[model samples]
Structures are given as C-alpha cells and as structure tokens.
Target: MASDMLLQHLDYLLALAAERHFGRAAARCHVSQPTLSVAIRRLEKDLGIVIVQRGHRFEGFTEEGRRVVTWAQRIIAERDDMLADLERMRGRLTVTARLGAIPTAVPASPFISGEFLRRNPAASVRIEALSSREIARQLADFEIDAGLTYLDDEAPPGTRSVVLYREQYVLVAPAANHLMNAPEVAWSDAAGLELCVLMTTMRNRRILDANMAAEGVQYRPVVEAASVDALYAHLSHSGRATIASTAWLPQLGVPAGFAARPMVQHGPRPVIGLVVPDRAPASIVAAALAEVADDVDLEAHIAAAWDAAGDRRG
Candidate 1:
C-alpha cells in the first residue's frame, strides 16, 4: 500500500515537472493545487530528499528533483510496458500513440497515419508538428512515441531512424513573379527575391541558409514564420516567395495564381524519416508503427511527384 501511494505521488511529480507550475500541474493531474503540493511533500518525506524548490511560486526542481523525475519516467514507462505486454498477449492492444513531426513533414502525416491505422485497426494516432530539436528532446524524455524528422548526421542516443523519403526543395511564388515560369530556380537567384521563410530556429531554415551561403548569396527574408502554414498565409497576401519541400507541394496545393518551381542549385537532399526510441523491450504500439513505417512507400510517391512536376515544366 505504501508503494502504491509512492507511485501515485510520482505521477504528481512528473506532472509538475512537465507543467513547471503548481497550479497548472495540479490541473493536469485533475487535483487541486494544495492537494498536489501535499502529495509532493509526502513524496519528499518518504524519499528523504527535497525534490522541488519552493518560493512565492514554483521556482524550479532541485538537482535531486531532476534525478527523481528521470527515475519516475522510467518507472512509469515500465508500468505502461507491462500493461501493453499483457494486452498484446490477450490480442487487444489498444493504445493511442503520439507522433512528433517537424513542421516541414506535416504534409506527409496523413499518409503515415492512414497506413498505420489500416494495419493496427485498434490503435489511433496523435500527430503534433514540432521543431526537429523539440522532437529530439521529446523522444529523449519519452514525451512522444515516435518522430518524423530529418535524419541528421548524428542520430540522438537511444533512438533509431529509418529513412522514408528524400526531401527536395522548390520555390513558390505568385504567377506574376518573373521566376514562376522558370523550369528551375538557382539558390543565388532565389536569394535576390523578396522572400518569406521559416524562422531561423527551424532546421529547414538553417538548411536553406547554408545552401545560399555556399553560393555566396546573402539576403534577408521579408517575413519569418514558425510553421509552413503561416508561411503560406503570408505568401497568399503578398507577392513574396517562400521555399518548401517538393513533396509537400501536392498537399499545400499551389494557391491560385501561384506556381512552384524545383530548386536546382541547392546542396544535398535531406532525408526525412521515422525515428523511434530503441528501448530494450519496445512498446507494442511503437513496434506496430515501425512495422507500418517499413511498409510505407513514401519514396515512390515523392519520386512520382517530382517527375510529374518536371513534366509540367516541359
């Protein structure tokens, strides 16, 4: 019974860690702030250490608090794993898996989710558009079950990736824009155009910046947004152009009076893929998602789109 009480308190601690505010964490846990505070204090007394720093408000976690949070995560994960294993054995693995994807990969999510659901009829998916760095951090913290993001040169520890498609860029501009009719646009040429781009924090923006720098092209963007949808919204109202992956164009639908031209003078194509944590005993849902990812023919679809876009230019 004492162990059960400790487990309950651990849940409250993890919620506090995530929310970083006592009131918010209490709300998340469906308890009053004072109740949550008492639970945490009881946990500290049981553990013989202080976990959270107190002040007028929630200051932060102590060093010991951080370590306890890590252990709490592992303990909770193990409990879920046991439950999942039991459900799998009973042939009733019903779990909602959370997938974190970079904003640029949002267009591909429907296909991925559709296929995964088709294979695992009992399982549902929740996809969130996150930055690449956030995806990595979430994966490390077990906040997300899987991630769809660029397969960077260095994979994060405890994670494995499988390439799904090669991401190629294109320039999107209004039909009246001079470069819209061009078969291919060079990085240097794009640098001269008034542009709206992803914020510098995004990996896609960094890649675009590096490609332009390689060609000795330097220019400032007229607008910056965190998501591709915001970029599109800005482009819809102005004559300014934006860079986006070729594979995402079909989903974005060339807006009325807008055209997309393949970017020819860029650096190497970046590979975007599904990344899952490599737990010793993977969750049944993660295993199912990986199996579905292996069967998805994303590359073929991307290639077909690329060829069709080129044919349109001819």
Candidate 2:
C-alpha cells in the first residue's frame, strides 16, 4: 500500500502539520492549496484511513494522522541516515578527526581548521592538548589524524610534516626579580635564581635543561607544576623565575609584578610542524586540513599576539 503513494508528497503532510492551515502549508510546500489538499487526500485514501479532520477552519488530525506524522519523522530520519551511510560507502566519506597540540600551537589551529572546514564542509574536526612527544606518538600510531609539535632536527620516519612555527625559550619572572631590568637575559644569568618549570617528562623541560647545561648554569625550582597554570601560579607568588616557550607567554596573563623576556642563546630555534603519517593517502578531509595549514600566517599571527601582550604590559 505504501509503495503505491507518491513519497514526494510526504513533505506536504509535514508542512501541513507545521502550519496547521491549508493556505500557509501549501505556500510552504511551494504548491497550490488545492494541489497540496488533493495530495493529502490521496495519501489518506491510499492508507485507508482519515489523516486529517476538516472543519469550518482547519481542525487537528485524526489518531491515524498523528501516527502517520510519527512515522514520517522516523522515515525521514532513517532516510537521511541511509544517505550519509551510502556517501561513506561510496568513498565520499565525511571524516571526523582529533588533533593535539601544545598550548602555544593552539592559536594556529583555528585559522587552519577554519579554512579547512570552509573548503570541506563535510569533514568534522576536534582539537586537544598534547605534548610534542605525545603528538609524535599519536600520529605514528594513527590514533590522532594529525598533530602539531616541535619538529626536532630528526624528523619521525614514515610521516610527512610542514614546519609551522619556530620557538625560543623565554624567562617569565616577577618584576621584583632583578633580571627583568635587563634588556635580554643570558641562560647563565638565571643560574643563581630559584626556578619553577614543568616536570622533566616534557620535551620543553629537556630543552630548558640543555640550554642550562650549555651555559654551565644550575638552578632548582622551589615548587613544581604539571601544567602552564601551575607554572604561572608558582611564578606569580614564589618570587622565582620560570623558563617557558615565548609562544606561551601571551596566554599566561602575567600579573603586574611579572614580565617575560626572550633568552639569548646561540642554539637553533625549535621548529614546530604539522605532521601526518605518510603510510596511507590522506582522506579528502585530511588533505583539506593539510592544505589549510599550508596557507597559515604563522609569523604574523605570532608577532601580533606578542605585540598585543606588549601593549597590555605597557
């Protein structure tokens, strides 16, 4: 019986239910009132039930009509689901991806991901926080679709990467700390001072250690923190200096007594890059995301953020 009815006309019934009036319903359906009414009547006849109870004005639907409305909703939902499934099966799949990055790398994502979505509306994206090593491992394992991390001199094998930004360590200390008065502080200049830093497990911490060792400087933190928040909290009140990426300073919200200054080191700047494993061809979504990353304004974005922070400090 259902096979005999025009499936295209089910829209008219939905429109009628929404408008509850013949003129508006037909107008919404983009058909003449008589055309829509005739279609609904035809549907009722095919189903062998009274779908709508007519009156001087428009009255409500009969019990069977209400049931038909419920059925229409289920049918529409199922139809859309099937269409999405079919698209995936046909290699036009809509992919959902998770990406992780260090706190500093977070800003680059919106610009890149925004343009990606504009180009590929069918793709879905998610962003999360992860350390450089974690980013590398996740990409290698295919657990995350992509990652942004410091691209050490040795690039990971079986992966492709595009250098996104370079990072230099900086000193963030309370203004009361004498080092702030200097235009630039050398790694050795921090030797005698108390320090707070993320634990040794983080790549950032390792870089800090290398810089200190290169300068033959040694210091210990009176307090330890796992995250940027804790690092800054200790920085704000501990009267000690913390070393971190200059990229992270903008979001740290340094209090009145704190200021960040770049470190003077002869070592190479750490290059942060967007990485994807090269083992397989990128899906349409991942390809679109990679294209977006290629077009990002890394220098300008970082310069602007730093400039804005400088303005706030002034």
Candidate 3:
C-alpha cells in the first residue's frame, strides 16, 4: 500500500463526505463518479477497511470515513499554510480588514485606504463589510488585520483600539411626524412611539436599546431594516421614526417630508474607531498604520458631532 497514492485520494474522499453524494463530489473534483469511486475503492483496499457505505440516497460515511475526513482537513490546512508562506516570500502581502459601521462610516473607509496604500504599497488589502460581532470574531481568528467599529463599550479581550470619530445620535422621522416641530424630546418621551430602526444585530441598534432600557422606555418598532436602503424605503411611505447618526443623515437623502433632530438628554453616541489584535510584535505595516490612524483629528470629529447636535436643537 503506497501511502503517497492513498494521500492523493484523500481529497476525493473528503469531497465525497462533504457533498454526501458521489456525483456532486465528482463534479467538484472535475472527475466522473466512476473514476472517483474507483480511486476511493483503491484507497480503501490499501487501508484494509471500508470508508463509505453506498446506498441509493447517498447514505452516510463509515466511522473510518469520519477519521479520514479529519485527517484530510488537517492536510488541507497545512497545504494552505505552506502556500501562504510561499506567497509571503514572493512579496505578496495579503491583509484583510473587516470593517463594521453604522452605514455612515462606510464612506469614511476610503480616507483610511489612501493613507494605508501610501504606507504599504506592496500589500494587497481585502475589505469585508461586517456587523460588529462579526468584526470581533474575525479579529480573534486572525482572519482580519484590523476592523473599524464602535469603541464606546468594553472591547473583547486581546485587542487594542483607537477612536476615529464620534457620531451624534439624532431622531429621524417622516417630516409629517409630530416630533418634527419640537426642538428636542427626552428619552422619557420615547415610549409608545412606533419606530423604525436598523435591525438589532447592529451595534448602533444595541446602543439605542440600552439607552431606551435605561430610561424605562419601551418601543415597538413597526419597521425593522437591516440597511440604509431598507430604512429609507419604509420611511418614505409610512410615519415610522428612527434614530440615526448625524454624519449619516445628509447621505441618506431622506425624502422631502422627512425630518431629523437631536434628542434632549441625548443618548450616548458611539465612538467610531479601529481595533487590532494586541498580539506580540505587530507587522511593520500594521504598526505604522495604527500609529497614523490614531494620530488623526479624532477629537475634532467628536467636537463636530456635538456642534452639529447643538445646531439641530437650536
């Protein structure tokens, strides 16, 4: 039994196990099911055990098949690691950034990119749009080089952060809504209002949730939207109201009948920022980028948010 030959069939076996259908696995491997079946049979013969149990409905893998799949995954992982090392040696730096924002800061990312490219021209960057929890998980797995997310709350372990901006939370409603006439309304006045909000998955939504809970205000949002477009769609036809960051308002292009104002006893606004792993000895580009982004006019952004909020009230 040549172990090398068995190793060659490992990929086929794993694919078959994953797809759980012979024809699909063969298609994935670019081979005929008969060819893959023969190869797997040869591998099983060499190992002196049955690996797969055949059936009309693509029945399950044998116990030994599960073990083989585990080994195959480890083998593939090592292969990926080896390829990454080779790519690194060839001077192809692959860094992924998972960024999460309140739909407002999506535009702000390009500003960081200009500076990032200036510093690391040799590196290739991949950007992922993620929610805050997704950003944190990707950072923990070393899947992302850095993330842009809210920095007001306690950060997850093994990460460092720098505030990039502060965003003012404002009340948004159809221009016809009653709150439009008032300069401001307190959180205590928020109850019994039909609201429209970004889905609870967003960090921005969570911040509002906490504030409302603290004020003993209970809101039942008649509309829930996951993105800016969805929020706008609902706001156009109905009297639904929502909270939005001031930076995001001008970009939303709200219809003529829509209005926005700052809340009295304003809720806590999130500090937008970048976060990176606090691992030992950061990459040269990573270290330099963090230093530069941190030194930017972050405090000025905070002041701007406050000033904008004040003007809206006045």
**Model 2 TM-score (2 dp):** 0.63
lDDT of 3 by residue, 163-270 (tens): 787776667766666676787766656545667787888877777777788877777778787775666677676667677666554335335666666676444556
lDDT of each: 0.83, 0.71, 0.66
Per-residue lDDT of candidate 2, residues 114-135 (tens digit): 7766655776779887777777
TM-score of each: 0.93, 0.63, 0.62
Candidate 1: residue 195 lDDT (0-100): 91
Clashes found in each candidate (C-alpha, N, C closer than 3 A)? 0, 1, 1
- RMSD of every candidate to native, in Å, equals 1.9, 14.8, 6.2
Instruction: Tell me, by lDDT, which candidate is best.
Output: 1
Model 3 TM-score on a 0 to 1 scale: 0.62
User: Which digits, one per residue and each the tens of the lDDT, describe model 1 over residues 1-314?
Assistant: 36869888989998999999999999999999999999999999888899999999999999999999999988877777788788878877677889998889988877788898776678788999988889988888878888888897644567888788888888888777778677788889998888989889888898999989888889899999988888888887678888888767656756666777878755568989889999888866777777878888988876666666553332
Clashing pairs in 1: none
The parts of candidate 3 lying over 4 Å away from their true place are 1-107, 114-125, 188-193, 253-255, 266-268, 298-314
Task: Between candidates 1 and 2, name the one with more favorable TM-score.
Answer: 1
